[model samples]
Target chain A: MTNDASPNTQPTYYQEVERKGYSRRDFIGFVTMMTAFMGLEKSAIGQVAKALETKPRIPVIWLHFQECTCCSESFIRSSHPIVADILLDKISLDYSETLMAASGFQAEEAMKNTMTKYKGEYILCVEGSVPTGADGVYCMIGGKTSMQILEEAAAGAKAVIAWGSCASNGCVQSAKPNPTKATPIHKLLKANVPLIKVPGCPPIGEVMAGVIVHLVTFGKIPELDRVGRPKAFYSKRVHDSCYRRPFYDAGLFVETFDDENAKKGYCLYKVGCKGPSTYNACGVMKWNNGTSYPIQSGHPCIGCSEENYWDNGRLYERASAFAGFGIEANADTLGKVALAATGVAVAAHAVATNVRKKKLIFELEKEGKQSEQELKS
Target chain B: MANKYLHIHRLRRVYVWELPVRFYHWLNALVIIALIATGFYIANPLAIQSQHEASGQYTMGWIRYIHFAAAYLFFFNFLFRLYWGFVGNKYANWKQFLPISKKFFKEMWYVFRMDIMMLKGKEHMSIGHNAMAGFIYFLTFIAFLVQCLTGFGLYAPMSTWWLPKLFTWVPAVFGGDILTRQIHHWSMWFFILFAVIHVYLVFYHDYVEGRGEISSMGGGWKFIEEEVFERNHHQTPNPEN
Candidate 1:
């Protein structure tokens, strides 16, 4: 319960930026862009700038368990060099297994120092899911199970951030038949801290930066959607903001990779673009410095940001197929078979009903004729 | 035998279905047909390849609009039908749909034996839907709810409107978007199956029983033989059972 962040004692984010040799103009420009990214009105830019200038940097303990480290790679190698430098410095990131030069006991000591010094004040950013199988033997770091480490680190944190789809929703390892029993951070953490999930295979670098900045800027988690994702970034589906949306509306689509439609940049929906279902900021912000994304490069979105995306369907197939209706059966095939069977059964039933009716009528007519003849005789 | 002595000395026309009931039936049929066509198209859009600019053509957009519009109509129509079930006549009452009574099950078994098993028994007919048909329609209503839920669930993310937003939890329950879409697709097939068998049975019953089975839906009246009417009236004090 120690509040180590006495603003006078520790250097503010502004001072850190200045010490890191970034001009004041750069700091203000970054803050303005961040404010806009957070879906704030223009009036809030000054308020955010003032807060960051005086507020002490929040210490972050970034933990990695069963992950590819793509989230870490994306963060450090953000296309915008200033974002990488300032965000890296602004968080005062105390320990990251991937980025920190220290290893073994030294790295552990750095993490321990931050956890103890800023108890209940530092942010815990989990980059991967914790494998809980075999009492969490599947993923162990520094001779400690991910479950034990996550529980220990999360115990004294003020707030927790599940970094990528892996930490947020159990990305790849927790796909069907997950042997390690990989569980997302939200399910593993027993602490009652606020958890913000930034779910993507590797969420856009700027999005990751935006989430961290929003916390440090506002001193609270940004407004989240039903699934606990930041509403500003995850509110709209990629298809809603895509540049090629007109083509989708027009029913113009690329039939195949080598087709003329592909050259013309028609909508890639028919070729299995999942932009319509996947909620993320890729279409609006783009990737690689807002230059191009997967769709722009003539490839369809695999819905890496969505939960259970790996098991939804084939990466390049439409969402017509599902697991419930047999292994290879899809909507069309199943529907057609069902309709056909009904058609055949109805035809057969009609024939049987007609034959039965005809026999009954004939019998009744014969009986009536015989009765009339007997009465006349 | 009873057949030798059987005589239809009089045929009386009795009003069975009310105008509102007939209206709901026809409207539901049309709406379901439109929804299925538009739903399939949305799932896999036709590659019309408009020669004009994408901005000029709104083929997929118009189709989706029609689908959503029809969906709203379907929803409200269902609600109206549910309201009518409580307040409408005995033939149209919600009680007719539930197989709660022992006599209802007996009648269901008789209908199953005579119609499905093709047993040689006296023609079992009712002024409105038979026990078997009423039960099946009840199940279809459940499917209708599923269709509405999953349909609105998929549309929620695309819509800023509050109504569709309320159904956002549907996808999570079904696991994800693809599965929700799959369930919606499956419900369409159920309607198709129901439609096929329903039409066939209507035609078959019209020919066999000759009680105006097909025309009763359009005219809201059915011609019943006097003897058969008297027997049915005595048997069913509660017409629903």
Candidate 2:
């Protein structure tokens, strides 16, 4: 918690963060940027900056379960300093298997001490799905089941944040025909806890930081979706504000990944871009600080934000049907409907023609009778 | 003195479907068929197009135009139907459409059992649509409502202010335009499937019972047999029995 930045032989991680020429102004700017990325209104920036500047440091116990650890990788690479340094470092991350210096008993003690000392105060961030089958023997950390560890840590935590799709929705571990019976954090833990889901295969780094900052700043969990994702980040679909949306509207699309259309950056709907169905802010806030997103990088979005994304469909195949706006525009349906309309029109015309023919016959017969009478006279 | 022949009273026909109602029904049917056909093509054009390149090539664009035109008609028909449900006859009323009474469940059960029995060669007759068909009809009507809702929801993002607000719930619940479009597209299949089954069942039942059910929609009458009338013990008999 102390800023021991004396001109010494070794510059600490804190000193490197400051010595990289980040002044109080730069720090505040980062806070403002984070506020926007977190989808907080302009009014909340001041509070966020104040919280970052004043709060000593929230004690964090980052647990890695049956996961790929990509969430941790994504977190450290956050574009902003307040995210990369302050939240990750200044937050007093007491224990993390991948990032922590201590090991074995020393690491275990640090986690246990933090939980006991900062009970009901420290933040608990779970990074993977926990397997509940077979007494949780599927995943073991230091001879203890992840379920036991998770419960023990979550019981004393002030707030619980499921850091990735693995923890949030069980990811591929809980896909169809799942043998391990993997369970998400929300499902494993009792419902009353304030659980925030940051779901993605590897969630956007800034989004991960944003959730943490929002919690630290407002002293409460952010608004979440029905699936428990933070609405601030998950409220909008990637397609809503995608740069390539005009192409989708114009009906221009990339037919294949290797096609010239792909280079042209046309919409990837034809090549199985799930942007139209997936909800996430990747297209707007973007990854690695607006540098590029999946679509921008010439790859279609696989809808990692959605639940059971891995099992939705084949990655290369387009969806059988698009839902919503493009409904009546489907070519086959339109053709059939048009043909049916034509049939109806023809039927109506035929009836009209028959009526006209009957009227004409009656008039002609009357005229023929009148002419006969004239001839007789 | 015994009369050689009895004088019979002629019944006057009453107007059941008004101009607007008939127009709406026929127009909706036309448009729905167009939408479904074009939608299927759009879903997988290559499947049908493989037969003949020249014919299939020209059809897509024309079909799209027809589809959009039908969609507009469908939208208007929906609006009119919404209005008519309140102002139209007792049969067309909103109350008639919603099954809110115990009799509805009883009717539904009877219709379900009758349908099963009929499928197994047991003959049963009803004056109006049998219960299962009635329920399906009601379901199709609701599906149309959903189609309109999801359709407009997707359309709202492209359109201007007030029109979009009407479908605000679409984006609010479904995460905006793209998702709304996906929902709208997928629902067309439901409509298409319903139409195919509906037409088939109408003909199937009519043929099996010799009821002329299909022609009743066009001609508005079917000849009832004296035997059926006597069996039912009704003064007036149902034509399509």
| Candidate 1 C-alpha lDDT tens digits along B62-120 | 99999999999999999999999999988889988899998778778878888888887
* lDDT (Cα atoms) of all candidates against the true structure: 0.84, 0.69
- For model 1, the docking class works out as medium
Clashing pairs in 1: none
What are the per-model DockQ values? 0.50, 0.07
The candidate 1 chain B region of ten consecutive residues with least summed lDDT is B232-241
Model 2 TM-score, 2 decimals: 0.71
**Best candidate according to DockQ:** 1
* Candidate closest to the true structure, highest TM-score: 1
lDDT, candidate 1, equals 0.84
Q: Compose the digit string of candidate 2's lDDT tens values, residues B84-120.
A: 9899864456655556776566656665444433222
Please give, for every candidate in the order listed, the TM-score of chain B alone compared with the true chain B: 0.92, 0.70
* TM-score of predicted chain B, candidate 2: 0.70
